[model samples]
Target chain A: MKIAVCVKQVPDTWAQKRLDPDDKTLDRESVDGVINELDEYAIEEALQLGEATSGEVVVITMGPDKASETVRKALAMGADSAIHVCDAALHGSDALATSLVLAKVIGDRGFDLAIFGSESTDARMSVIPAMVAERLGQAQLTFAGKVDVEGSTVKIRRIAEHGYDEVTASLPAVISVVEKINEPRYPSFKGIMAAKKKPVERLTLAEVGVPADQVGLAAVASAVESFESAPPRAAGTVVTDEGDGGVKIAEYLSSQKFI
Target chain B: MAEILVLADHSGGEVKKVTLELLTLARSLGEPSAVVVGAGAGSTVDALAEYGARRVYVAEDAELDRHPVAPAAEVLVQLVGPHSPAAVLIASTADGKEIAARLAVRIDSGLITDAVQVDADLTATQSIFGGSVIVKSRVTRGTPVITVRPNSTAPEAAAGPCEREDLSISLSDGASRAVITNRVEEKHDARPELAEAAVVVSGGRGVGGADGFKVIEALADALGGAVGASRAATDAGWYPHQYQVGQTGKTVSPQLYVAAGISGAIQHRAGMQTSKNIVVINKDPEAPIFEVADFGVVGDLFSVVPQLTEEVVKRK
Candidate 1:
């Protein structure tokens, strides 16, 4: 079996992400970047599937050159190789346009299965994998918490309102991994060393056969104009730890009609 | 005339509330047309009409109804090929997002998911990275495809002269990528979905144990609120992950959010900080939850929640 996992590098959520004053873009200078948390689950699921089926796991990412770091982490987690579709032109591409580039590349590779995190950490749109499947004319399963591979059939479970729902898709389909699917493994020292030598294939729009008219932000059907922060949270009405604190709290709730 | 296509999300003929919410959003852009593909769709059409659908495109077939996502996309692609909707709005559920992505690719359009607000100009506001940031974007070239986040819009029922149109679509051989080998549906009473609830009561590490959550549940019931928990509570195995409301959990934007014994980490805030009004009950005055809360009480949750529940029930 051949499995392809899509991952992306995003600013660490804990890092203070300020908007760049010049262009209103994210301020990258002070932030640390890492593979999106959800994508880690995808890589782990692919590796586990590989272990079960005696297959190879190929990690795929589309971003600027630095995105190789994200792919390297996947490589360090037992993926056999990595493919990085790197180019400056791909920058600022929305989920739709980004998936266009990804679908084109994966179509060429012809993998048995493709996986992605439910959504990217920064964008969190959760649209790319399904778009890839649509573009490639493949079956798609999203937000899967559990995926079991049996020959050419794939059975999966996804988070639902009350509980989980099971779904089955044929091979050569697209699946988006959710958090509950698996606990992602930490990169091991040996795997880290091996990742340095893992084959990292780089492709650009020209190599992927994407015409200039078919890529970039121009291909995006939407654009953001301006934004402002959500309303600042109001300061709480503090009460001192006085006598009968519980009584004081109850009285407050009553007075405010919250009770 | 350009129409805004809404993929009806329903099960057993009961339309999900978000379907109406999406219709409300679709109306903001243009004429709202519902694409109903599944069982009991005639009832769905009526429901869609009551909520405000100008047209209902019905795609009824065995292959389309039994399995929802892929065939729905196939139906939409056929709809898109002829109708050429200005935008396609789907509820940003797990299934909905997948279908939207697939359809976007089939039509070679720009796809944006988890959009909190879809504006008239086509710019969509999305709460990304667990609601830490709100970024707006639009697809520049092809038709705009988007999945609207839950609770982003209030469903407004506008009676419309809904016109029903039957759509004939042939399912692609590739449509059934994954077959449904088995399906297990969860059984629960009619309870308010967490995202759609106006009031929410959540617990965290301070709840102590599984039994300790009973008081929180009572309080939530008294307030007609949905129950939620922090990642810490979920991680500790006190509650399931679905009840968790934090960065890695579900995002909720209720009108009133009551946090009991929660420390309010940035991650937890990412899921619910957008709430209209916040109230926190914790022993520690310095708990970060207070920073974002409009109301705070420094007391033990065990004692306070019960009294609050009792009072609320009495008032009701």
Candidate 2:
């Protein structure tokens, strides 16, 4: 069995991110980039599955040249090899185009299963996994909090409104796992050194057989017409407690008609 | 006039509040036509009509309820082929987004998720990057398929006599690939839901431990509000992660929000800054939470919270 894990590099969650004033796009240059926090869990799950089945795990990502760092991180975490689809024409692609490119790559690899985080930290669209599955005409199981893979069937505990539901799908399916699935392991020094020698395959839009006109900023189906920075919060009155602060708060609530 | 299709989200014959909110928003763009799936359309028709639904499409199929998402998307795609409505609106729940994505893929339409506002011209306002940036967008391709965030708009009734249309669709073989085998409903709690509550009180790492949530719960009960927690508190095991209010957790825009002992990191603020009024209580005088607070009290939350709850109870 062969496994594919899709990963993305996003701005660090702790960094102060900004948007470009002209195009309203994210100012990626201003912040430090790291592998999306949740993708680490996906990589770990794939590595564990690979070990259990005596198979191989392949990590794939689509981004600019700097994204190689993200692929290297996954390789260091125990993936057998890596694939990076780097092309200027892929910039500003919407979820549909992105899913198409990923599905093409996964189909070419002929994997038994594909894994992804429930959503990226930056986009947070939570729709790409389903879109990719639709493009491939395969089964999609998302928001999996617990996963178990038997001979040819995969069962998952899916999180829902109130509780959870048990969902099952066959092999050659796509699934997205949530953060609660498992704890990710840190890469050892030996693994890091080994990753330096592993194969890293690079592909472009044409190399992957994706038409240039079907992707990129010009091909996007949605356009941002306008944007504005969030307004700063104004300073309000602060009351120091002198054993009567509770009474003052009660008065304020009353004045605001909250009581 | 073009009709706007709304996917009604219902459970046990009762429609969710987000569905009504979507109907209200749909009416602003075009005539609202609700598409009810599964077996509960009869029970939801009156409520859908009350919210300005001019027509209701009832698609009662047991296969839809048994399978996950794909069957429902198939129904929508079949309807879209004939109706060609101006747009489709759905609540931005996990399941709803997946359905919308599949529908968009099948129909070759543009899909937008987590929209906070929609205009008469069909432009949408989205708060991206955890509400730090606001962008106005419009679909440039086929009919727009949008999933709106809950609590973004209030529901208003516009009573009308609704027309009903029964839709019949054939389920494709691929629709049954992923099947749900079992479901477990969580134990019910008496407190109001965090997203629907008008007033919310949240605690953070400053609360210290699991037992420390007692004061926060007492305050919420006294004020008839809901209780929430920062991710830091949930990650520390002080509360359940479901109750966490942050970028990664739930986004709540209530009428009144009270923060106790939270320092208001950007991630935490993203969930609650859209609230109408904010009140903060923290021992740290220079906490970031005070900057966004309408009222601030500098003191120990352990001491301040109990007294505030007592005052609220007394007033009531």
Candidate 3:
């Protein structure tokens, strides 16, 4: 019942993120980095599942050397170990390339299940889980609000358009969870001390069998052609309610043909 | 003319507004051809034709509906090899993006999601980091697979005779990896879908509790619009999470968005900033939502919302 959870290091949501002027890609260095908010939920879910089944949870992340800080945070939260896929040539890889490397790593590691956040706050593509599942030739159950495992069968309450649906798949599958699934736990001081000694394995692209020709900015399948800053919002008209505010709103709605 | 393939989204034998919006955007890129999957393609042809679909590829395979999204991606993969369209457009719904992702992998194409705009040259304008940054991107390797955000464009009616092409697709074992055991349709409400609604009334933490949503619902009903809630309210269990409007929630670009008792956080603003017109009502005058609002009213929502609903009802 070993599980692998994918985590990403992203610019903190509170900090203002900017795009690089030359390449139109995210300027990661300009802002402070933190683990993506949603991935915390995935880490927590994996830890809980591990405790429930007496299994091991391994945290995997792909980024520069600094991304190990993110993996340490997950280990402090109770994962068994960590895997860091760090390489200079992996920069600016598209979802396809990223999923390729992840699939290869997870496939080699031999996990009973793989977990991912529904999307990354940075890219917000929400595609990697499906792509990795397709590449690994495994079942994918994404956007799960609730997950349950029983006797090699995994069941999930999938978030659908209006409501939810019950979806089921076999073991050795991939799943991505939504934020509503569970509350993430904070790392205690004892956990933080213990995490420092936990095993962290670092791997390069070549170690993972990813060809040098398939990744990086030059080999990226997608390219940013251009960018434009969003237009500044105009000053809005504010009205203090002096008992006639409702009347003012009605007039405004009518002026806009809304009512 | 180069053809752009669009995956038509339909439910209950009717085409969704997002599909029409995709068709409208597709026409600007190239000649729009719709790939209709499931049992209702025949019934949806008229609407597709009205929205400028020159050709509709129909795959009436029952396995598509029985299984999850893999079968549809397989169908699209088969079509991509033969048609070699300039680009593929899909609605950026949960299921739609999944299909697009699988199709991109199967065909080894670059994929873009949540595109707010696509230029005639096929460059996609993406609003990322909770709408804090905008990047224009394009697929450099192969035919681009793009998922357009709902309500990004207004659907325009352009009459055309839609030619139908029947597609016979065989499902692979991978397509049946995940099976849907049961489905429960959401309760039908008269209000329009939040993503497609012209007007949306949303509440936030200032609403106090679940009971406070009554005033918001009344105002929404009076306006014949959809009801939305901020993540704060939804997380507090005041409303269903599905109705949440924020970075982690649904992105809505309605014509008019009313925020009552909402002290708009950046996450919430990211979902609704593209709205054509925004109105904010809050007790706090320093609310961030007022920054992007077209009009603002500083007052308590309980008093302001009920009076606004009454005024709106009286006007009609």
Candidate 4:
């Protein structure tokens, strides 16, 4: 079985984020980049599946050449090879455009399975994998908490509002892993050295058959207007812990209608 | 006039509350059309009509059942070919958001996720940088695809003419990825999800350990509100990630949000600062939660929560 895992390099959410002075969008410059949190689960799942079936895991990501860092990290984690879809036209592409680029690459490259994190932390859209599956006409599962493989078929456990439901489908599909799926493994020193020798192929929009006219911010459908800051919170009044602490507490509760 | 497509989330053939909320927001962009993909009865369609859905798209294929996020996207894309909606609206849950992303890509359109507001002009507003900033975005390019945050809009009860149309899409091999052979959903004694709920009651570090959360839960139950926990509590492993309320957790804008024993970190406020009315109860008079509170009580939670629950129960 061959699996393709989609990953995105986003600003380490732990780091502080600032807005661009010219545009309302986030300031990506100087932000420390890291593999999206959820994508780590996707890569781990792919590696595990590859080990079980004695197959291979292929890492796919779209970004500037710097995105190779995410690919290198995936390779260090146990993927067999990588594919980087890089192009200037891909900048500012929305989820739909991103998915289109991915679908083009996946369709041309071929894969038995495609996986993605539930959503990129920065964009938090969680739509690209589903879009790829739709474009590829593959069956897809979202927010998989658990997964099991049997022969060529896969079964997934999804968490719903009221209860968990089990759904089974054939391979050559896509699944967006939820946070609860599995804990991702940190890259080992040995694995990092080995990753240097692994194969990582780079593809462009033309190479993947994606027409230049079909990609980029110009192809997007939505637009943003002016933004306003959320209203400032009102000041708060603190009740002192007087000698009768319990009584004061009770009185406060009663005043607030808690009693 | 552009048509906005909405995916109706349902259970046991009944439309979920978030579905109505999605439709309510969908109406902001253009005509609202609901797509219900699954088995079971037609009760969901009726509910969609009640929520002012002008068209109900139904696709009941056994193969489509549990196809996960991938095939679901295919179904919607197939539906979009003919209808060509200006935007597609879905709930910003784990699954809903994923499917919307895929649809946006398949159609080569723009996608805005976790949107708090959808204006008449189709601009999408999102709370970014942990709710410290509100960023308004427009897909200057394809169909504007958006996943709306739950509870962003009060579901208006306005019934519209209902027309049901069954959609058909050919599922391609390898399109269905990651199949679920089994599922085990953790049971919650509380009401609906905090993000999708109209009312929420949350606890923070002041509640102490996992056991203290019971008091918060009890108060939440009395008010039929979902339970939320601050990042401090979740980080302490006292609550599940689903219950976490902060920049890293789910974003909720409900009618009423009650904070108990919470200090209201900046990250925690980022998740729920948009609530209509906020009530904070903390033992520490200096806790930050009181800063944005509409009502505040300075007292020990251990003694305050039980009495609050009793009062709420009595009123109920």
lDDT of 2 by residue, B1-316 (tens): 8999999988756888889999999989999999888877667888999999999988887667777888878888988889999999988888899999999889888888889899999999988776667889999999899999877788999999899888877878677788899988772366766766778999998999999999999999989888999989988889877678877677787889999989999889878887778999998998998988999899888888898899899888
Winning model by DockQ? 3
Evaluated on the second chain alone, the candidates' TM-scores are 0.93, 0.91, 0.95, 0.93
| Candidate 4 lDDT over residue span B33-61, tens digit each | 99887675255888898888998988776
Q: Candidate 1 falls in which docking quality class?
A: medium
Native-to-model Cα distance after best TM-score fit, residue B67 in candidate 2, in Å: 2.2
Can you write out model 3's per-residue Cα lDDT over B1-316, one digit (the tens) per residue?
8999999999855899999999999999999999999877667888999999999999986667776778889889999998899999999888898999999999999998889899999999987666656778889878899999887989999998889889898877777889989887783357877877888999999999999999999999999989999999999999988888887788888889999988888889878888889999998988888898899999888888889999999989
- Model 3 chain A scores worst on lDDT over the 10 consecutive residues at A21-30
Using lDDT, give the best candidate's number.
3
Over 4 Å off, model 2: A21-23, B187-189, B222-224, B313-316
Name the best candidate (by TM-score): 3
Model 1 misplaced regions, further than 4 Å: A19-30, A240-259, B119-123, B127-136
- Candidate 2 local accuracy as lDDT? 0.87
| Docking quality (DockQ) for each candidate | 0.51, 0.66, 0.70, 0.40
Per residue, candidate 1 scores C-alpha lDDT tens digits across B1-316 of 5699999987767888889999888888999999988767767888999888999998766567556478888888888888888988988776777787678777777777778888897788876544555677777657787888777888999987989998777778777655655556562344577866778899999999889989988888877778899989988889777788976677788778889999999889988988877888889988988888777788788877787776677766
RMSD of 1: 2.8
Candidate 4 residue-wise lDDT, A1-259, digit = tens? 8899999998876677776655444556679888887799999999888899998899999998888999999999989999999998887666666777888888777788888887777766556766777778776666677877898787776666555778777776777777657778889999999999999999888887888877675665665466656567666455543434334434544565544
Worst 10 residues of 1 chain B by lDDT: B181-190
User: What DockQ results for candidate 1?
Assistant: 0.51
